[model samples]
Target: MATIYDVARLADVSAKTVSRVLNGDGPVGARTREAVQDAMAKLGYVPSNAARTMRSNRSGLVGLITGAITGAQESARPFGLPDLLIVQGIQRVMASRDMTLMIADTGGRADRVPHLVRTFLEHRAEGLIYVAEYHQQIRLPQVPDATPLVLVNCFDDAQSPAVLPDDRQGQHALVRRLVAAGHRRIAYLTLRADMEATPLRTAGYQDALAEAGLPFDPAIVRIGYQSDEEGEMQLLWDAIDDLLRLPEPPTVLCCGNDAMAMRVYGILRSRGVRVPDDMSVAGYDNHRIIAETLYPPLTTVELPYAAMGMKAADRLMSLIAGQGREEPAPTLVTGPVLWRDSVVERRAATLQSISL
Candidate 1:
């Protein structure tokens, strides 16, 4: 129940000075600032966010809308990497700026977003961030009176500022690496057609193949719903069977994500297929579990999830400062490929058909 007055009295400074330090409106002497901070810390002072909103008409809070924590029946926890990492990054930046975060869960239901936005607005949240369960098209809720908003990992054709991993770049980088290592017949295991990220990644894969002058064969690509790791394993096994039966089976397999790559490893091991010898594998989204658990560490792309969160927070802060929202174009962030033991060089094919 410590108030600014109590802190000022204890620190022997005026309440206005304390307020200035708290709000960062005007500069205070270092010694005075330190004294006030120490006194506030000793008194366990907590600012009333509600009162601040009432007085300033700004909550200084950013609302983050996420998908429900629990995954659907067969779906693995959607948006795991982007959700965790992006939040971490956002928190890091917000801490530095002395801001607060509010969260809402949509559970893969688009209808829930408007309610969440209204709640955030009711609470006087200064800005909003809409995060999706997966890389899918988003129909965003209209912010009341043009409230500042940003989308995370979801793009709306109507135009909205967003932060998401550059799947196309990541995919091309992955394939280019594998191709240079001598993998000509690279197989791509991807998610179903409904997902936007799937197509972007698929396009990148095709671009890589075309650049390498490798014939694009529909048979080498397998697409299925990504429900859970166990279910994906079954689908992956079936896909592997189909691929292995081909006259020219791929030596390297590029998966859509780390989870799928893990399943690929399990299926390959069960069938006595040597990793990086008989076949190599790579994937996007460097999930912590997959990176550390596999016998041979996975070579995957590290999505800048935390960075995305941090950037979103920064942009939201700008909006809250009355700077206005940026144009409604999603910002693409590129993730770097993490080289690991999962891929090996193909020494046999020195000269092959190179695409223009």
Candidate 2:
């Protein structure tokens, strides 16, 4: 029921002086500041943020659209939910900037994106971020030309600015590490051929092998995972059986993700293959819950979900600041590899040219 003017009147100070004290933008004596504060407490006065937003023409609100909040379908990228990590990363940055974040969950439905977008527009969000369930190309409905938008874990045919994980680099680093540990006969079980990361990560595997002066053997690599689809388990077992039946069995097996690697462990045990003893293993997506809880623990490369979110938020903020009008090239972020007891150190890591 009270306003800044009431507090100013009771404090016997000019409205402008009271404002200076409240905003801490201009010089005000300690006694005047104390009197203003005391008057505000007495009057139970509270500043209206809505009025401030109207005056500044800045909502200080960022809109994020994702299906991760209420849970989405499990994807092959990570064994667990990665969208939550990405959202948490974005929230950290927005909070540090003193900006509010408005999130909308579509219950894992892409068809509902347009509605979320309109809701954010109605709120006058200064910037917007779209977080995908996985790394892939996306086609969005038409958004306002003036609205700054950034994509995380995905890109578009329109060449919109986006932040994506460095799939090639991450796989390359993992393979290179394997090679350095003297894993000459390493078998790779990859995601389905249709997935975007499959080709890039395969290329990385080959790159690392070539760098280590090892020959590329197609027989060792096989499609081992799909989008949690039926018949996916059969594909994995077949790949594992083929690898084991080879005359020259692999010293290590690298899987598409932590979940697959976990499955691989069980399969190998059932078939009398002891990890890091008879064979070693590696995985992608350093999902701590599965990786850390495994018997010997998992050695894997991070998917960089959190880092991608931060980069996406930063890019969106830059666009909102009017940095440029041209569509930006997708930014690539790489994550580190974690070493664990799942791998046997046949030798010290010796590859020098191998870079992540």
TM-scores for the candidates: 0.81, 0.88
Weakest lDDT window of 10 consecutive positions for candidate 2: 347-356
C-alpha RMSD for every candidate? 4.6, 4.4
Q: Stretches of candidate 1 above 4 Å error? A: 1-55, 68-82, 107-111, 228-231, 322-328, 348-356
Tens-digit lDDT string for candidate 2 (1-356): 99889999999999999989877779999999999999999999998767677878899999999878666454444454368899989998888888899999888788999999999988889988999877889998887888988889889987888889999999999999988787899899998788889999999999999999999999999998866645767888898999899999889999998989988898899999998798898988888988999989999999888888887877787788898557557899999999999999876443443532
Q: Highest lDDT among the candidates is held by which one?
A: 2
- Give all candidates' CA lDDT scores: 0.79, 0.87
Clashing residue pairs in candidate 2, if any?
none
Model 2, backbone clash pairs (residues 3+ apart or across chains), number? 0
Q: After superposition, how far is residue 229 of candidate 1 from its true place, in Å?
A: 5.3
lDDT of 1 by residue, 63-127 (tens): 88886343333354532364656666777887898778887777767688789888988887777
